[model samples]
Target: MSLHGIGLVFLAVLTGTASVLLAVALLRWWDRGPGRRGARLPQGLDGSLKPMVLLFRGQRLVDATPPARALLDRISAPESEWTRLLQWIGPRFPDAIDGLSRIGRAGRFECLGQSGTGSATLRLLVEQIDSDLLRITITDPQAEYAGIVVDSMSQQAMEEELDLLRRSLDQTPMLVWRQDAEERVTWANAAYLRKAEAQADEPIGWPLPRLLDSPRPVPGAGTRTRRASLTQNGAVFWYDCHSHPTGDQTMMFALPADAAVRAERSLREFVQTLTKTFADLPIGLAIFDRQRHLQLFNPALIDLTSLPTGFLTARPTLFDLLDKLRELRMVPEPKDFRSWRQQMSDLESAAATGHHVEEWSLPGGQTYRVTGRPHPDGAVAFLFEDITSEMSLTRRFRAEMTLGHSILDGLGDAVAVFGQDGQVIMSNRPYRELWPGAESLAEALACWQAGAEAGSGVAALGARLTQAETGLRDTGLMAGPQGQLLGWAVTKLGAGRQMVRFRLPDPAAAALADDKAMLASAG
Candidate 1:
């Protein structure tokens, strides 16, 4: 055989061997699949056909599988990839981040998702790749190993319930948020976000800004509440913040309190105005509550009662106030202390049911008109009025009237005064004796006509009594019922009144008149 022929056979054999090796390598690569070859998932998570895996170095995201990347993309948050991933996973596995510390000691740890998260088989796996690197794996063990079978009806119901809850939280007017042990906000509802945005100069991001100041000595077990305020666009908004501890985190809710705050402010202002008005009042006023404790008083009360300001300001009970007044001699002197107490008890009862009035004649010669009135809600009010001057004036006027009446009774002639309405207003003792039953002007005129002669000027006296003119006077002679000579006169008085008088003619004047008549007859 020739040498060239042997070399050609060996070259052909080598080329055939190389081609077989290349074909075997291509077949093995095709069997590995795109998931295993294209994206490098975490070690244990590679078995999943579509694993959601993320790798983080400290707080920065080093890498993520395609599914994890898609999840991060679906979450709309202005935060880094690590924060975005945590936001997605935290609701399902609340302890996901908390368990990371344990991974450093244990190398790897697993946690189950919260119940009612739609899938009971959900799990999260955290592994410490190194001192600074962490690998997080989220999967459904049932779906991966045992095959997941779902009831469509139950799934739809759960989805509907979740949607309703989401809508309710978002549409609520209250601001709700959850905070971690570090007092950093982890989650917030739509309302909270809107408020944060309104107050913030920049766009809101992850770890949402806290709307209310964190309560000191962190709330535990039960709920704690406080009032909080926020200013937006120069307008202040008020809220009642309620915080309730939930597991390792806290759930906080802020309800609108603007209306309540405004109402309280208005009530305070109204009370201030009432206090000012009472201060300037002239009438002494003291108001006691339903419990009989002094609640309100005026400056006039202090001046009139002469009670110590400190004692009044101490809010003394009704009995205490009365006892102090007795000690000060500001009240009427009672027969005894026991009787005074009984009287006060009755006064209180009467005042509560209706009005009560009493005149206190003090030892200091001051008369006080104390009035008690029932106030709303079973309360009683006492008004102390110093009526000393008024009482003195009234007594003096009454004495003057008595003196005037006595002077009229001492007159020698019968005098009667008639009012404008033709009613007999006043009569002296002699006048009453002269006309026994002349109670009015008409009756008096009838008596006079019956006693006097027909041409005795009785008609002229009636006309003068009835006239509206003042300061008119007339006098004449008349024959009495006993045939005796009588002198009569009518004088108009003030206020359309008239005075009528009657007296017997003097004997001396009658004799002189007789002598004159005799002389005239002889001539």
Candidate 2:
């Protein structure tokens, strides 16, 4: 009951109260570990309302909320996949576990329910509390961003990164797409939707194979581009697609190849048409390309040149072809061996201007007409035609005409021939002497009046000959100015021709001419 006893008891009560308060503070600090500092779960979520959440230390599932536990029980099948926490989460559980184990500090991924569980996509968020601890919260993906706060700098950086990714995908000239194991379209860039002629909203859940007529490449095959086609805007579009497999999905890149395919088709058809046309050519044809290589030849060429088909098919150069032609005696040989190369060069130059021509008279008495012409694309075409028969006929006709002229010259009578156009085309030597003053038969007839006034009776001969050529014949007598008597005849020669001949008269005609001239003057 003294003062010292009362002070000691008050001190003991104060020490006990201090000790209890310190213990409570220590317990509170222990409960609020690094997990609380880093966790971003919803602040006001009740125990019953919050989505499933689980924490892992290394590979071990150390803690789980009530919803998490319930989900694990519902998904786990004791007979099959109930061995570990990862297996209990069902399909794609290893992906989640790998992320949780290997993430640097924080990460997020999508987890989908397997079979017919009807669970919406879960957005799994994982944060590292310490080097060995990871806190995971799986929530509805739609609400995953609800309780998260980001600093301005970090948010700006993320937005920039997202914008760069979007621009990269949109600006690329190729189509980029991603498909799940079931071959359904999960993501496609703007290029892909445009190529498929589909709206952006239609690609999700679309069957990727339906967009093209090509079959999917087998899995594990090396990455090789395969050609495929699509019908868009009522026209066929072509693509060369390259695929890459990653985990359970495939990524594809497609480049437009429609132009290349169309070009090839056009070239093929053009060649076919050329072949058909050349097949029927009678004249030998040889077409060389821009590089001076023999690109085409007809069957007539093979037969005309007597060259082997294989040699022509090998696409020999123009010089080589010419050399072969010389060796085969198909071309005319040049006289000077030293100038042959220059001659060939000159031939090429002349062919470029499309004026090269040559006649080949071969050892076998055959003649060929060869012509060189310019073709498209800096090419040249050579044509060969056999003209032996035509030349032979022309020579024969000239010889026959010369023989006929010799026979006509032997006749003593003055002879003149008129052609179909009423032109004097021929006169024998005697006829030229008889009509020394006239240049032609028509001129002689015009001057006959002068002869008649000088006492010659040949005035009506020209009119009679003209009538004979039109299906009439006349015979008459006449005298020249030297007081000689003559007999003349106008005869039809068929084919619109007439011949006029004059001969010395008999004795009776000579006497009759002299007496008739004196009697006419007296009358």
Candidate 3:
């Protein structure tokens, strides 16, 4: 063979070797598709990449990560749940026939039964593929770290945290609890356990029927009652219970003491606030019996009565108060003022009617208004106000009116008074000087309003002065034989009546003569 031919053969062999290596690499990459394509899956049991695994349902652990071991260690059931884990395994691994064929596959593993493997810790794997291949890369928590792995450390940490949490719950003045699927106490921190001991005679693990308010059909371990607590073995606890369904089990918790105490405090505060509001009311308030005796009275009543020594003075009878009022001139003295007889009659009539007794009045120069009503339950309510200034102003106005009438009469001219209804009520004797034939002041008013010597408009003016009022002051003019009488008149007496006055301008000599004649006549 030639040197060039040998070189060509060597090159071909190298090419063939490279091809085989490429095929092997491709096969490995394809088998790990799930792990190579981004972060597609969670970590495996040993925190390695999640390799392709074969699982048999009902025969393996539920979780496939290190955290799962720490978590599952707390579960009460481990082997009993194996049948459930078998459902998670692939179909091919458990269905195979040849054991050798199952054990021959490499890079395909399983979670070999957890057993003592001569060492405390060891990497566990099946190193074979079969009908129920459970490929896994497991590290025995007891072996790899020589019993120093997360099993002990994580458990210690969890227990410490639980202790701290228990202390927190115990510090509160409340009962706290955790219940199992059967409503039996699965866990009870110190506070709840003590209370339970006081109420229930049994310790933990007691049957839920003897411990809780179980439903008739047991509610399948997931039923709960609100505002209710487990009463284990004659023990009673108050709580609001709620059940959380986790697979075939349940969990429950509650806090009762704090809730009830807070509710009671709120109700008491509300009642106290209501009572204070009624007691401190600003309005004068009083309660009287059917016999007219005072039962309850507030500070406002005392201030109104101005009882210098206080109202507790001898429990004065109703008649006694009336007598005192009369003596003080606060009430009309029957001996001095019989005129109030009509007012008393009106009051009786008002009481007989359904009208509540109410009136405006002034006491010792203070004005007030009061109202009284009968209580349906044989009591009475009285409300009053002060109105003194208004009544005083009214009396002053009446006195001034009388004085004005007297001055008008003293004018030596014919003076007259008319009621608001347009009827003449009073007049001086001098009115006859103007019309001697007039019999009464009413007849004189009729003639003057008729204006016998006046034009049509003047008489109409007299009629208009008596027109219904529109609640406003009105003025009108009346013509008479007295030559443009200049009788300024105003309609103020209501219902069309006016205060009409007139006088002829006195001639200088005639006025002097009249003044002297009147004086001489007086003499």
Candidate 4:
């Protein structure tokens, strides 16, 4: 190499390096133009900045900043433009820019300018470096940042909701599975895997058919099957599986088909068991709500209430049973069903109270005793027992008992009142009518009256009279003896407390006939 040639080479290299450095400096200086020149926010700043495509070139403005979501919402014009047709009618943009007529000079924004109806405020900030490649930040009046606070709260709430859903479904002893839009498994709770014998380590990314039995997949098409489930081994199970597009793919889930079948079987068994049990029960049972609405009733209830055919008592809504209650339910003497409105009010006021048993005498001469208990949710269970036979017997006994009092007033015959024992108590009206009133019956029977209240005398008379009047005792009838019309006068008032009245001739014979009539009335 000669010295002269080396010097020339060095000189050319130096010139090229200088040119490159100068170009780099110019570019850096251009980028700083906006910042160095104290580019300040415009007065009364209201964000209305929008990027516009220059009409001179076939180009588009693109933004992929401030999170992908916000950027997309900004650039993609809605199908129906935000601008009105009337605004574009009388000259647009450039004509409306205040200072620059025929040329829009409103900083860096696309806007309706003045003559536009419902004119709004707008501001623009141009961000450019070097020649022209630019990004214009558009600030619209309605735009507001949903800052970190909202984002944090939203994320927390979503996490809690998902956690709760997971816990609820987990406790259910059933397998569950979920798939993503790509048909890949996104979630499968523990039960889903445990319930399935052949669950894979992870069910993600497998084709939809791969999770099931061998099946063909047609692009963009879907199909289902009931073959040997991929998740279960040695278990012949059916799954209702389907897919729906989520985002780029579909999400799918598999639920046990047997669960539904089992539920149906159980419901059927329960209904059958209840029908048998209800028919065997002697007491009628009808359940009603606080509103006096009947819910459940046995066959006896139907017989007693004369319920209609094809009545589904199990599902009777409260209002439905009101009609039935109005028919069969009744109240005893002095208290009728019509006055029972207060009972319903009090039952609903307090929770779970044991109320008094109510009785009713039906127009058909039948007696129905009703008792009710409140259920946990304010529903009441009403039990009705037919006691017509019992009540009839009781009333007859009372009538026969007072008959002695009727004769004691004046019978014109020899009469003796015993205190249920053989001890003579009173001579009665016939004696009082013949010998005049003597010691009161209670005083005369002194010793016998001592135990009369509790039937001590009553038991004694049964034994004493049994021996005295064999014929009368056999027929539960007794009249004065020494006369065909009368064997020995005897009467019984009660088992616990006894009163006996004896009469002669007509009174005794009349009493025997009355006794027969009383017993018949009781039945």
Best by lDDT: 1
Q: After aligning candidate 2 to the native by TM-score, how far in Å is the CA of 346 from where it should be?
A: 2.8
After superposition, candidate 4 runs with Cα above 4 Å error: 1-245, 252-275, 310-353, 396-523
lDDT of 1 by residue, 327-406 (tens): 99998889988999899999899888988898999999999999999999978899999999999999999999999889
TM-score for each prediction?
A: 0.61, 0.50, 0.30, 0.37
Relative to the unseen true structure, what is the C-alpha lDDT of residue 283 in candidate 2, on a scale of 0 to 100? 82
Per-residue C-alpha lDDT of model 2 across residues 1-523, encoded as one tens digit per residue: 9999999999999999999999999877766777565553353353224445677777677888665665566543654222444554435344676665457644444454332222234445677777877776655444434322112212333454577899899889878888877777888887776666553345544564336433355777856578888766578878888878877877778888988899989999999998888888778898888889998899988877898999999999988988888888776667875587788888887887776898888767888888999987899988888888988998899999888777777776878877777677887777777776555556767655454543334645766655544433376667654556667787778887878887844557669998999999999
RMSD of candidates 1 onward, in order: 17.7, 18.9, 23.6, 20.2
Name the better of 2 and 3 by TM-score: 2
Q: Which ten residues in a row have the lowest lDDT in candidate 3?
A: 113-122
Report the lDDT tens digits of candidate 3 across residue range 1-523: 9999999999999999999999999977876777565533333344543222223332554335444343344445546444322322222234322332455454344443222212223233444334554444334444333233334334444555576776787786544445555556555556656665666556644432233442322455556555655554675556655555555445544556445756877999997785576457644455456665656555655565554334524455444443454555555335444555555445434443444645434345555555555666666655544446667788899999888767766775554545665456655555545545544435654667555454554445445454554543333344654544534344355653445455545668678999999999999
Which of the numbered candidates is closest to the native, going by highest TM-score?
1
**Per-residue lDDT value at 448 in model 4:** 35
How many steric clashes between backbone atoms does each model show? 0, 0, 39, 19
Query: lDDT for each of the candidates?
Result: 0.82, 0.70, 0.51, 0.50
- Model 1 residue runs over 4 Å out of place are 1-157, 214-221, 413-427, 436-458, 465-523
